[model samples]
Target: MTTRFFLTSAATTLLAAIACGPAHAAPDLEAAQAIVDEHSQIPTFEPPGEPFDAKACMADKKLFSVPTSSSIPFVDGIETSMEEVAEEIGFEFQQWKNQAQPTQWVQGMEFAINNGFDGIDLMAGIIPSSLGPQAAAAKAAGIQVFATHWADTTTPDDPAATHSFPIPYTRVGEIIGAWITVKTEGKANVLIIGSDDVPATTPYRKSVQATLDKLCDGGCSHTYVNVPVAEWATKIQTNVQGALIADPTINYIVPIYDSMSQFVLPALTITGKKGQVKIATFNGTPFVIDLVRQGEVEMDIGESLGWIARSTIDAEMRSLCGLDVPEDLYVPLLIFDKDNAETAGVPAGFNQGYGDEHVSGYRKLWGLE
Candidate 1:
């Protein structure tokens, strides 16, 4: 129950007034299209003289697979982007779902390997206790591994050996912290809802904490509320509801992902403080974007858009093709608020796949196309 508030009542009022102004306008399709077109115009980086033979890379008989247990919206995005990449590169693609269970993760890993995958694209936020061994066994089998979201380096072996590219989760935290500071007018009493299952959660939490400590005067004081990893939505709702009942003074709530934030939103509704508390979260799912547009969520750090999946696939392809691979690759973070949620659109693999142009730009970077 470590909660710290930086702004006094007067400061909070002033900040609120500033935020209430017409700070941002509605989404414009033309503007968004222009931005996307600009991004497309940017030249793709080509490896020096095509070091690996693309023909040989595509001829690998084994399957290219992505493994996950659910959680992030971008898992679907990853799969969609991978499918497109596979089509472009002429490789078979497979996907396995663990439904966010530790046991299921092991099962998925075993299943993928048994099914004859030559390479694997691992998602972020799986239970590391299971992941460490699964990754080790996969490596032992000489299967190439690529990772997104959580750094694959957290595996048992030397990180360099386990993952072809490690996405920087800390930088994402910094982006989130900056957005929160602005949205809350430099005064936020943040409650960090976390999961125990994912090893990446620890780093993600710490990075946000560190960023707040550095940016907000009096340091961003927060309470770390532990939520059940399996039933995160229920736990978050229960905890948030209880917290609001006890102290209706909470100014901000930040969850690790949108699915968990679903709980907090209902708690805010029950407390009759729907838009009063500044809600911030990770993973720009459609629900989160709607919350932002409706002025329910103040800001969200969008990790969706399939950047990790594409990166994982690219790394796997590179490794299998014997190309030089980077030790770590960072996926850029987008701060979504009422100003930009509409254009962000539905994530990939939804009823209509293909995320917004902004997300596609990051995807292109990962795929290097």
Candidate 2:
């Protein structure tokens, strides 16, 4: 499947020219605005390939998944939707319950191998390389082992794993950076928060930095802080608060993951900088959308959780059925801001704003309709 890389080098060069100047140099507002406008519209579903008989291929197959953490609402929501899709395709899909621990991930792999499951998916943020021995053992036992929603679109697959359902993390980052540049009108002092443990975060920050460099033209300055996933609840607030206190000029806070907003909101409140510093982030998490609705968060780049589940299942099922797997998960991202945040629902609902085109789209592709 042909996937869209949101920001191209040609586009970047056309945006602005880097010049030696003090921070907050004039940015190319026209270019930044164009980037923001392009992503404002709702995205449509694109089939990864020609339709195939999914039911016939999945007749007796079973899939067992291990998520980074069952405690995370985002991970849980996707896992639940995945099971719903698996049932429609006549495959047994079970999640190996765990609390973001490598030991549990190993155990999940062992269970899948021992029980003769046809496929095992390491879902969302669980690094595959860390479980090399378990992955090798699963492969030896003829179990198809791969990661879903764990890597960026550009990341190389871990040799120990079979394949991946990569997401457009870098694209999401570029959108966030463009949003910041446009809103600040060429002057943006931003704080970027991310987790080092999550492999996808690497590309997310890289793309955001690159976009800022190109569009801001030395007009934007940013500070990056790494807070591991486990420490988000405790560390994010302190880190954000400290940064705000140290640099009162910051106008935006960009969290690579929307869930980090929970901690960020309190930091803004504690520092009395809620309105002073706007927020822009990725992930279409419901709570974050509500923040946008209430005008707390300035913008959020969202990928439908339901859409993600279907795309991931489609790829994994294709692999098990001896069909060609798409190069990347064909899921698309939508920009959510105050103007359209309420469309997701007054209080916001998981995967609610994005139309359900993918629901019917996948049904047709899999011959379920």
Candidate 3:
């Protein structure tokens, strides 16, 4: 299938995973309004340094990237960045295929270490505990490993495992929850589907729950179901169906990542809950942007995969070259809704952040120009 079609298929098959994977309004309306208002505007990240020598830094270098979910659109974006950057800088960039499970990532690391890849990029879903001995092996083999999104960040600093960036997942949760509160006038029944396998998702889930609990207090209620990423494809629909069936009062279905829309939307259809429940989530993948624009999704708090891809590549490459890395090398998220989807969302087929100058921004930083 074509790459675009493949992403759509994957988006459907993967909704989000082994994984796992809000409210609005009130006198507290001020806070919720602020959350939405702040994100309503586009976010830009300009590097804070002069260009370094890219040719010298990447000369004869090679890297392997292990993505937790190759089928996910966000992962596709990261791979695009790696390939584009690799082509421009003359480095060998190889990515493991269809690594949708945690175990596959561990094995990918072992392959990278054994096969002499110079660096490793840890995409969001690869857990730290799952690394087993591969991390040490990579370090021992003189490989530089940089992580972004959701790799276990608790470890004491390791040179090989150096450099990590942000997505502000907790804030993402808070914003979604607040949006829910505002929309329902602080009285929405929410069914939240999440993945237990993704540890980072824990905080996002908790923050959302906390927001609902705090804002609604006695007025609103939410039921949460956690599944692992490995089983998300098979379990998400059933789990969500069960939650809705058990409590038919559920008026909102919140999938932490917008990609989950693929799975959730169909489940809502099969369960005959389509259009009965509203959706609002994160990642604002291209499809999600369209969903928000078409009014299929109520809100999408989005981080541009295009921006993420570029930011992640710059972080990994710079760390590989021993340049100054920003403490927050993350691309910020923008909030999307019917009012702003037309302008706030990236144009369809334009790549997540194709409008941005991040490539040139990084090039100036690396003296690649």
TM-scores vs. true structure, each candidate: 0.74, 0.92, 0.84
- Candidate 3 C-alpha lDDT tens digits along 234-305: 888888888878888899988877777878877788788887899988876778778888878888887766
The models' CA-based lDDT, in order, is: 0.60, 0.88, 0.73
Report how far residue 1 has shifted in candidate 3, in Å: 84
Candidate 1 vs. true structure, TM-score = 0.74
**Candidate 1 residues 209-301, lDDT tens each?**
876665665434677787756776567788888887776767888787665766788889988878788777766566667777778787766
Task: Highest TM-score: give the candidate number.
Answer: 2
Better of 2 and 3 by TM-score: 2
Question: Model 2 over residues 257-291: C-alpha lDDT tens digits?
Answer: 88888899999999999888999998888888998
Least accurate 10 contiguous residues by lDDT in model 3: 18-27
- Judging by lDDT, tell me the better candidate of 1 and 2: 2
lDDT at 221 for candidate 1? 64
Descending-lDDT candidate ranking: 2, 3, 1
